[model samples]
Target: MNRQVERIFSQIDYLSSAPQADRYGLTKLKALRSEMERHRHEKYGLSEVISWAFRIKHALASQDHSDDWREGISWIGDPDASSVDRTLSYEYMRSDQKLVAGSIWNNYYPWIRRNGWSTIGSVHNSGMGAIATWILAVREVTKDSSQIVLLTTRLYFETRQLLQRLLFGTNVQVIECESDCEFLERIKEPTNSKVVAYLDSAEQSDSLSLFQRISSAPLPKPVVLVGWDNTLIPYWKNPVDSHTKLSAPLFLMRSLHKLDQLGLEVASAGLLTAASPAQLTPERARYLELLLSEVKNSMKVIGSTASPTTIRRLEAFRLPNADLAQDSNQAATAASDRFHDSISGVLPKYMEAVSYPHKVFVTIPLPGTNQESISKVMDQIVKQCTLSGLPVMRSPSVGYEFTSISSFLSESDTGDATRFLRVSPGGHDTDMIDEISQCFLSTVSNL
Candidate 1:
C-alpha cells in the first residue's frame, strides 16, 4: 500500500464523485493529449503545415479564377461561396475539433501573468522559430555586428552549439558558462554592445539572487532577458519568490507544441516581450518597443511569419491556456513527488542525492567514476522503464558529460563522468503515473 498508489486511487475516486461536467472536461483533456502525442511524431512539422495553411488561405482570398489556378489546386470549397471567392478549408479534422481546439486559450494570458510572466510582444512565430526570432531581434536591435550572448539555460551541449552557429560567426557570439556565477561575472564585462542573456528555470536555487543581482548591477549595455516556454511555464521566475517587475526587457518565447495540452501544436511560436499583467518601467518599455519591430521584421526576413491559421485556431480554442500549464504542472508535481517519496531514504544506494529541480522534470544523477559506468546505468534505467511501459526519456538536461540542467553545479563538479536522467509525468494520467512511480521505484531499489 504505497502512499503513491493510495493517492492515485483517491484521485480516481474523487473524479468518480465529481460533477458530470468536470469529468467530461477531464475526458476531453486526455483525448487532446493523446492526439498531440500522436501528431508530434508525424513527418510533417508544424512549419510545413503552416505553409499549407498559408497557401490555402491565399487561394481562398485570391481573385484568380483562371484555369491554371483551378487545375493546379485540388481542394473542395465551401458550397455557398461565389465563383470569384473560393472558401477552401482544411480537410483534416477531428469530430471533436471545436471541443478540443476551440478553447486552448481558456486560461490564456492570465495564467502567464498569474505565474509572474508578462506578455512581451504582440507578434509570434511557430515552434523553435519563436526562440530564433527572439535572438535575431536582440541581435538586430543591439546593432552590434559582433555582440556577446550569454546562455544559462540547461540544454544539451548540441543544442547550445546550435545557438552559436544560428547566425553569422561575427554577428552573435554565444558564451556557455559553466555556472551562473560566471554569467554574473561576464555580464559586467566592459562592452558597449547590446547584451542579451538567456536564463532558465527555478532549478537553480540561486535564480532569485541572480535576478536581484541583475537588477542592481550596472550593466555596460542595455540587456534583454529571453526564454522559451517562458510564455506560460518559465525558468525565468524564481519559484521561491517570484518578482514580477524587472529592470530589463523581458521576452518570453513560447512554443505551444508541448505547452498547450489541447494538441493545437499550432506550430505556433511567439516572442513575448514583457512578463505581463504588470506595469512596465520606462526603460523596459522602450526596449520592448525596439524588439517588437525587430522580431516582426526578422520573421519576415526568414520567411518564418506567424501562421494565421494557427493564430485563429489558438484564439478561437475554447480551453484556457492557464489550465493547460496548470494541469501540466500538477502532473509533473505528482510524478516528481511520487518519485522522491518512493526512493525517500534509499537514494544513496545507487546514485548521488537527487531532488525535484523543475515542475516538469526531476534529475537523478547516476553515481559513476567514468563515462562507461554512467552510460551503462542510464541504459539499465531506460531498459527498466521500457519494460515497465513507462515513457521515461533521455532528456537534454541529463547530459552524460559537460552538461547540466540550469547549471545547478559547476562543470568541473558534475560534468566529468556523471550522468543524470530527467523524468517527469507531465501530460500523463494519474493512474498511469502511479504505475510509472512504482516501476521506477522498484528499478532504483534493486540498483
Candidate 2:
C-alpha cells in the first residue's frame, strides 16, 4: 500500500473508533471533508486531495475485506516521510477534474455566509499586531471594492503609514483626519465610493457630528465605523448617542489591540515546513537560533513555556534591557526578575519540557473579551524576543481557555480543556511571513 494511503487509512480507523454520534467525531470528519473540498476546488493552493481520495478508497477497501484490512494496514511504515514523497503523491488536475476525481460535492459542501467586518478598538503605541488586524479588517470590508478613510493621530503618523504599507501597500489613499469636520469634507464627494471611516488619533474628540454626517448621508454602500482606544468611547457613554446619529449599523470591537493583532508574530517564527508536528531536536534548535538572529531589531519573539522553571531557564539566557534599567549594575540585577512572572507562570507543562524545533502555537479567546489586557502581555513578549533576537516557535495551544470537564467515569477523570493551536516557523522569508501572518490574522480579525 502507498504510504500516504496507509496514513489516511490509519486516520480513518482512528476516527471511526469513536462513537458515531460524538460531536467531536463529526467535527473532525467535517474538517477533513472541508479540507478535501477546498483542495479539490483549488481554493487552497495544493492538490493533496487526490492522495487523500486514494487513502479514503484504501480505507473503504480495508473495511470491505477484513483480511486485506489487517494485512494491508500491517504493510504501513516509513515514519519519517520525505517532503518530495508527500508533494509528488498528488498530480495537478483542472478544478472540475479535481472536484470529480477527489469525490467532493458528493460528500462535502461549503457555502459563503455574510459576516460583518470586525471593528478594531485600540490603536496606541501597539505595533505590528494592530496593523495586521487593520489589514485583515480592510481586506474583508473592501472585498467588494469599498474605499477606506483613515482618521489617524499625528503622533501615530509613522504607525499609520507603516500599517497602510503592510495592509494596502504604500499607494493606499489614507486621509489623515485631524478632526470630525475634516473627515466630513472628504466624504462629501458626490462619487459613489464605498465608505469606511477609521478613528485612531481622535479618540478623545467627539465623533457625534461625524456620526451624524454618516447617518445623514445616503451612502451608496454599507458604511463601517472602526474605532480604537476605549478611552474615546467609554463603556459608560451612551451607545444610543452614536447609534442615533449614525446611518449604518454600529459594530464595536473592545480591547482593540488584542482583537486586532492575531497572528502578528507568526511569520517571524517560520513557515509551514511540515503537516506533522516539528520534532524538537538540538540541530533544529541551532537552526532556530540562526533564524532568531536574523529577525529585525524592531520585531521580537515571545516564547510561552508551560513550565515556570523553563522560563527561569530562558531568563538565564536573557539579555539585559538597557531602557528599563537605571544603570548597568541595576540593569543586570533588576532585569532578571523584572519579567512579568504572572505571565510566565501560565506556561503549560508541554511548553517548558518540549525539545528543539519549536513550532510556535498561539491561541486567542473568543472575541470581544479583554483584548487590551492580553495585548499588553503579548506586546511585552514580542518586545523581549525582538530585543534578544531569538526566534520563538508559536504553539497553537496558547490561546485556549481551559476548563474542567465532568465525566461518567469519575471526577478524577477530568481532562484538559479543548484548544486550537496556531503553528508557524520563525525566519526571514518576507513572502512566507506575508502568507503566514495574513492567514493567521484573517481567522480572528473578524471577531
- The lDDT for every candidate, in the order shown, is 0.45, 0.29
Taking all chains together, the TM-score of candidate 2 against the true structure is 0.27
Candidate 2's residue-wise lDDT over 115-217, tens digit each?
Answer: 2111211211223333334444444444445444443332133345455565564323566665556666665555544445554422223553454455554
Q: How many residue pairs in model 1 have overlapping backbones?
A: 27
Please estimate how well model 1 matches the true structure, expressed as its whole-model Cα lDDT: 0.45
Candidate 1 segments whose C-alpha is farther than 4 A from its true place: 1-108, 111-127, 143-159, 171-173, 185-193, 201-209, 212-245, 262-271, 274-287, 303-319, 344-353, 365-420, 426-434, 441-447
RMSD, candidate 1, Å = 13.2
Q: Whole-model lDDT, candidate 2?
A: 0.29
* Candidate that would win on TM-score: 1
- Tens digit of lDDT per residue, candidate 1, span 1-447? 123223533432322111232242123333444444444322222222222223333333333324432221111221112321221122332111111222222223543445654443433455456666666777766554455555564544434444666655555666666667887777777775556777643344344455556655444444654443353354323432354344465555555544342322323444344453245556556667887777657766665544434444333232334433443345445555665565556666555445634444466665443456555555666677677765555433321111112212222335653455555443344455566566666665565
Report, for all candidates in order, the number of backbone clashes: 27, 24
